[model samples]
Target chain A: MSDDGFLRVADVSKWYGDEQVLHDVSFEMDRGDVTVLIGPSGSGKSTMLRCVNRLAEAQEGSILLDGEEVLSPDLDVNDLRREVGMVFQGFNLFAHLTAVGNVALGPRRVLGLSEAAARERAEAQLERVGLGDQFDSYPAELSGGQQQRVGIARALAMEPKLLLFDEPTSALDPELIGEVLEVMHGLVDEGMTMLVVTHEMSFAREVADEIVFLDDGRVVERGPPDQLFERPERERTGRFLERIASHD
Target chain B: MAGATRPATVRERVADSDRSVGRLLLVAAGALFWGWLVVSWVNRWLGGVLVPVGDPLVPPGAVEATLAAIPGIAAYAADAAFVVELSPEIARGTWLTVVITAASLVVGFFIAVPLAVTRVYGRFSAWVSLAYTELLRGTPLLAQLFVLHYGLNLGSYVPDTLSGVFARNVVWVAIVGFTLNGAAYQAEYIRGAIESVEEGQITAGRAIGLSKLETIYYVVLPQGLRYAIPSWTNEFVYLIKYSSLAAFITVPELYYRADQIASETFRYTLIFIVTGVTYLALVLTASKLMERVESRVSIPGLGVDRER
Candidate 1:
């Protein structure tokens, strides 16, 4: 693990009764860097992200944030969750709220920010993602790309220590994907720590500081993007790349 | 004639031959069936049927008598004034019914929501949720009412609050029946609404640092309530009608007061029919209110953007 890492996943294991999903998965994420997780469907990639945020309980391991074991049974799980914000593939904006209201909800409720202050922070975050004009728009009114950007802004509004993305662009149209990816790229430019699950190889190749490949619930390979993309060490990496590239 | 009467048209020739049969047989069969019934009925009416062979009660000329009495019956027919006249009695009964329903709904919320939570997201067997849905849904509400009102009321060891209440007052019986029946139905409505909330929203709430309970209160419930609106309103209508069951006990609610009026005046049909109309009005109001709320919360562009 890097000395300057912001988050750590250490031997986290999860099971649903008889069926096991994640098995002793471990990884370290550095501050202000984007770690993109690329994997086949049901590879437990999304489950790993959920575990980091304590969305799903981990059976046998810990997730550490800032040298604190946040996922330990004794730890305040809510505090950990607040610190790590997640944007989902489905852009989980509150259907009843306007885009701005959806973004403001977390801080106002959990952080005890006044409605006015939360609205201010919310607008600022939306503006940063170039959604300043659509502040009052409901998620239903937004395009898939726009809704996803709103999702990103909603997470960013909390000023979280880390952001988790579970296939953010998967639900967007091909054209719409660029707008959201650009928003993500802008966040990366600002040195926000991000963990993303994505199928967009080009975005990963272009923006990721590190790429972690998972297959069958284990990390197959991970390293600097240029090295891993330019020269994969394993034959399986080549086969995986072939399968992915063949999709388009 | 059959051979020679190969007349102008096939229709005429067939009719000519068939006309030979007398109408007497058809007349006799019809008369025999009806006459036999009339004779037997008359004999019974005139004199008692010989021991256990047939019914001996006098035949009633109900239809003609009923027609003749229509004017008198209409004079005693129930009106809005009946609801007004019985206001105090009806109010006592209605109050008892309302109190029972409201208390049950409020208390059921506490039990239903937590049970719904356990049913929806809890780690125990899926059967935990399944059994709850089935138990509440599969059983007849009338049976539930009877059990709570009568069966449980009969049990020896059950406390006064549980069993004793039934003997003293109609209100207690109403409360017991309302809670037992309403709670089961409510659990299902709540469960459906909770499930309708997108899982992603829950994850979002969690990501924002809200606990599971908070996420439910803040995120899922608000969303679930929207889905629950029409169903809940329908339940309100149901609660009103179900409250009438209170009348069967000593509670002098609307129907009970009306029943007494009908029994005294022998105007049963008129009063009962009007009571049915009263419920119609009650349910109609509920339906309209629910429709208004659905429109109020609905955002403009839910389905259209999906295509775009």
Candidate 2:
């Protein structure tokens, strides 16, 4: 019931059939905060972030976006999704649409912006993500990194209160990962509220205000990125960090 | 990763041109061989059919005179002139066939989309669409036309003005039957395309704040419809040919006109050949038009276009 934070996920749990993917999880993010969720595969990091926009519904929990009950039965889900934008791991840009078209769709359809206004906003977002020249390019024409940036632009075009990224750079070619991360880094610099799920420890270290380390569907540790990444207090957290470091 | 290279040397370019020329010559030769085969077959068939039957009892001139006395020569001349004596009745009937096919498709498309969406993704109402689609598709179009035109007999049940309209216009019965029949097949094509859309696209749509209906409308249907174009084009051409079925109902479509002309002049070959060519033109034009539309809507790296 508290409204101390801009977004809150309290006592959240989720299941896919018989398997509980997320345990009781709680985290809070203030306005303009960047929270990075890092964990092993299937650690429920993506599932937790998905709960905020009701993309993956939480079985037991409260998610408040801009202090409104996101988990409420009568909540306008589309409105929640408008407030909470998401960048997919697969960069699921509409293949039929050009980059600008994909970015403008939510603005025109959901926000009911006039076509000119939506186009203007989409152009701005696409330019912001360093894709000024790709306005007319289809997703297939663009590189994986460029497509992900368009994905980010699509999310940003909504001017959402919060942005969720699910392993945004994981699907990119190794050489192209920096371009997408650079855009996210720019967002953090501009004080955007972002909940990121990624294995990019360097991005988390540099941009995240705090890092929540999850393992086995549970939050094992939460602290400032410097303390959590470098000086992890829990043994499991330390071991997980060591494993990822070696894997990289 | 390689550095830009200079243009090819003169000898290399000449060699490349020579190679392409050789390939083109080979292709031309193959095409000519196939054309020769087709020409020879046509020549054989024509020779057999056009030869006057030799009766030892009668002279060739007498036979020719006898044939000329009949209407067959005039009819054959009419066919050759590209000005066959088609009655106004046949003309109007053919136009009516066009109207029925086009109207049925337009109306059928509207019916099919919703029917397909409900059948593929709906809860309880899906079964209702399933039943309707299956039942219509299971029965023959002729039987359905007969049921509407003769069995139900809308003429007797309707008001006097509409009753006269329904009874007098046999094309209306054919239209209703074709629309119902086409809708079922169209729904299957549309539904298959809709299902072919990746699940990820739907998630992406929803993630960007589109409602379920909006997602289907904006994302799913556009892609699905593009994917369905080839099948849909097939259906359109089928409708054009199938409109001939209206002839049984006395709608006087091209086939019916040909039948009437054949019956009147007793030159079945001439009338039928012209009629066959007309239908061929219709099918070819429809295919070309739809192919243009399909290419225009095709996603660059998705569906059938991905092959390129």
How much lDDT does each candidate structure score? 0.74, 0.83
TM-score of chain A of 2: 0.97
TM-score of chain A of each: 0.96, 0.97
For model 2 chain B, the run of ten residues with the poorest summed lDDT:
B49-58
Model 1 chain A weakest 10-residue run by lDDT:
A1-10
- Give the per-residue lDDT digits (tens) of candidate 1, residues B1-308: 36665436888767766664444554465454335434544444456353122431222233334444678665443443343343333333334444566776667666667667777878774467667657766887667666765777633445666654433454665665676567667777877888977787887888888878888888887777667766777677788788777776555666776788788868677667756755555455457667888788866553233324
Measured by TM-score, the strongest candidate is 2
RMSD (Cα, Å) of candidate 2?
A: 9.1
Q: Which segments of model 2 are wrong by more than 4 Å?
A: A1-3, B1-83, B87-91, B155-168, B304-308
Q: Candidate 1 regions off by >4 Å? A: A1-3, A10-26, A57-63, A246-248, B1-111, B122-169, B172-176, B299-308
**TM-score values for chain B across all models:** 0.60, 0.70
In candidate 1, residue B94 scores what lDDT? 38
> What are the per-residue Cα lDDT tens digits for candidate 1 across A168-233?
999888889989988888888888899999989988999898898888778888887888887999
Candidate 1 lDDT score at position B122: 81
| True contacts reproduced, candidate 1 | 0.76
The CAPRI classification for model 2 reads as medium
